[model samples]
Target: MVLRIFGLSFAVTVVSIIIAALYGGPQAVLLVVILSILEISLSFDNAVINATVLRRMSEFWQKIFLTVGIVIAVFGMRLVFPLVIVWLASGLGPVLALDLALNPPADDAAYFPDGSPSYETLLTDAHPQIAAFGGMFLLMLFLGFILEEREITWLSWLEKPLARAGKLDQLAVIVAGGLLLLTASYIAPEDTVSTVMVAGVLGMITYIAVNGLGELFNTPEEDENGEVVEGSSGGPTELAKATGKAGFFLFLYLEVLDASFSFDGVIGAFAITSDPIIIALGLGFVGAMFVRSITVFLVRKGTLSDYVYLEHGAHWAIGALAVILLVSIGYHVNENVTGLVGVALIGAAFISSILRNRKAAAAGGSSDNDVDEPKPVTIS
Candidate 1:
């Protein structure tokens, strides 16, 4: 299963290296390798979250995620997204933005003469709004999950209290709003404060709107003998069947989720090399392929249900990432530091999961085989 899942990823890696070598020789090849590794490390949590969501989606959507989703990730987010940022920041058209990307100025002064921000500079100027939007979106995701009551928790001592507090109406939104105000005031520049705040609010609104619509339009499940079983009315249910509207929204959700995850990596890639094509080749293609491979592996192995608290850990990591992104609006955080924090949090959760499994075995609750084995999936 591992080999089969990763076969395409490996091929992509080779292609990335060849592209780099042809584009910029041995040095660029090395850059591509490093950037790919960096993206994978920074995005491990993304893979886990993707798996969590993908497993619930219909098989058709899963295939769409693999095929169509990759196009959006590699081309839309990595390529066009940056160009769009440049266009917005510099008031340049798409062709002009593409030109600036292909032909960057000799120095920062040249940018002023042309009245156009270089691609990298435009991306840098747009960082605050990008960070605010992605951060708030990620915060909402984390808060929504953490605030929900769950049977299994990695950090029971704290999680139990948070779960109790979950009963508060609109608690996540309120906290997210408060954080947005505080974050905007503290980190955003005086001129860009309103932009930051507005972006943050839009991020929150996007999350609420997408989720609300998904829940409202979610279809009922069909049981054996082709009978329609009514689904729960109070909350959103996993999509059992992918209709046109439902599937589109799920696709949108995943794409937005991918964009949020890519924001940091895209920015961080500039720190390594300013050549947009190389960055796209390394992080966009190679790194994204591996992420998809990891997601598929996790889903096929039933890793989430087996480990139990792994999802909790991923959400916590996301919260930490959200905070870091918002703080980065004012501060220069090393990407290595951000990546390590996620690794540490997820690592601790994995350990906790192991300990829980041992305890369950000792209590004769379930054997390792019972826990780790993948269950049959119903894909309609």
Candidate 2:
């Protein structure tokens, strides 16, 4: 499997290097590799999350995820999301920024000899803003989770209705993504840190809101053969199909969510190193392998049921990332604190799950295998 993964990655690296060098020549190869590594580390959790979703998708969609999804990820999110985020942070978009940074005034043409913007000018224009964006994103993620959690308590009266409204996991993610975009555009300061913070926090929000609400609304059902379907509300036949679709969409949602989580790690890596070619190739190839393997593991090995609350741990990490990003936006976001708080919360949850498992064992309580896991799904 490792060799296979490497071989696949080599193919992808060659592709990325070719793409990166389209403008900058062979020198850009270094940049692609470096970026690739950064993305892989940041997106490990994303792979686990993707597996949960990939398991539910049709084989056709699964293929789409591996191929088309990679395009969306490497090109759309990695390449384009940064520019959009930076534009939002600075209030001067690519065109305007290029004009100002290169010309020192919007009035001049500011055209490069090659008819392109200078590398130094663009970097200087966006670095501080990206950092600030990253910082803000982390902080907001932390606060939003805490805040939304509180809303759960306050909405005791309308709990059922609101939950129903929030029932669509896809909608929840869309909302979170939209919110992040809005915040980055309107609220975050114009600096590099802020840009990164916004992306990270948005990723955190989408993960938390989608997963949290979906978990809350989860119910169980019974099949025609009288076998119980885990995590269902005992709904009728029609809803069972809906559940299947929801399960499938939930999987797609996870992939998008993972992509978002990967943004900060990708960008932060730039500060530690240079070489865009290395950056792209390394991050794209490694991240691809990680997510694909995870998808396979969950589908084949049934690991999701075995390790209950592992996903919860990831969501908590996203929440912490949000706060870290936010704090870093205006001030400094401490890695230790960000990591510690997330670890504590998720650790406590995991321990609680283990303890629950132990107690269940003592009482012969049902395992998630008997609960969350159902009969093997057929893609047909």
Candidate 3:
């Protein structure tokens, strides 16, 4: 099962390394390997979150995620996203932006040796707005998830209070908006405050629009009396698997979620190397494929169902990342610190899940072992 799931990722890793060797010899090969590891480690939580969404999708859309979605993720995000940022941030036309990326100026300290900003400089210079947008979007995601009432709780001490707060309509938006304004006013640079505000508001709007549309189109499961039936354990229920427009919006949400997660990784790749080709090879070809494969593995193996707290862990990691991104606008946060924070949260969750499973087994709760079969979902 492992080989079947990850075979393509492994194969791509080999080919990408070979190409990197040819492009810049052993040094490029090493950089690609490091960048791939960096992306995977940084995005481990992303894979878990993705699995939660992917499991709701039909097989057709699942294939689309692997095939067409991969094309978008690899080329559109890894390569073109940087170019767009440079174009918009620098007011350079698309042609010049592409040219700058292809032929980055020589580095000297911060700026180019010729005193012009390098491609990396332009990209990093745009970090405040990027962080604002992606950070707000992810913050909304985390907030919305934790605020909702659920049958199962991972960190009951914290989640119980949040769930009570969820009883208030739009509490998630209220908190997220307050944070955005606070960060923009005090945390972001004065000159970039307006830009940060606009980006952050747009991020909040995008999440609401997509998620709202999805829920609007989704038809929840109904009992014989036509009453809606909620999930027993309360995460993504079978309603999430709706086809047509609901599915499309859910798919759109997944893509945006991925972009938000990848924002930091794409920008951080410059610290390793400025070669766009190498970055794409490592992040797009190698890192992204493995994330997709891991998502598939989790969905097919029912890993999320088996380890109930894993989803909670991933969302908490996302919350931490959101805070880090917002904090990074005003202060430099080490990439290692960002990565380790996520790892630590997820590791703790995993251990907690094991203990729960053992306790259930010791109590001879055989009923707890069975995963609920997804019910048929209606789409309006």
On lDDT, the leading prediction is 3
Q: List model 2 lDDT by residue over 102-128, tens digit each.
A: 235332234433344343334434533
Which is the winner by lDDT between candidate 2 and candidate 3? 3
lDDT assessment of candidate 3: 0.83
Where does the lowest 10-residue lDDT sum fall in candidate 1? 230-239
In terms of lDDT, the poorest run of 10 residues in model 3 is: 371-380
The pairs that clash in candidate 1 are none
lDDT of 3 by residue, 268-301 (tens): 8888998889999999999999998888887877
Give the clash total for candidate 2. 77
lDDT tens digits by residue: candidate 1, 120-212: 877988999999999998999898888887656678789989989989999999999999999888877788899899989999998888777
Cα lDDT for residue 213, model 2? 49
Task: List residue ranges in candidate 1 displaced over 4 A.
Answer: 107-116, 220-244, 366-380
- Estimate every model's Cα lDDT from 0 to 1: 0.82, 0.50, 0.83
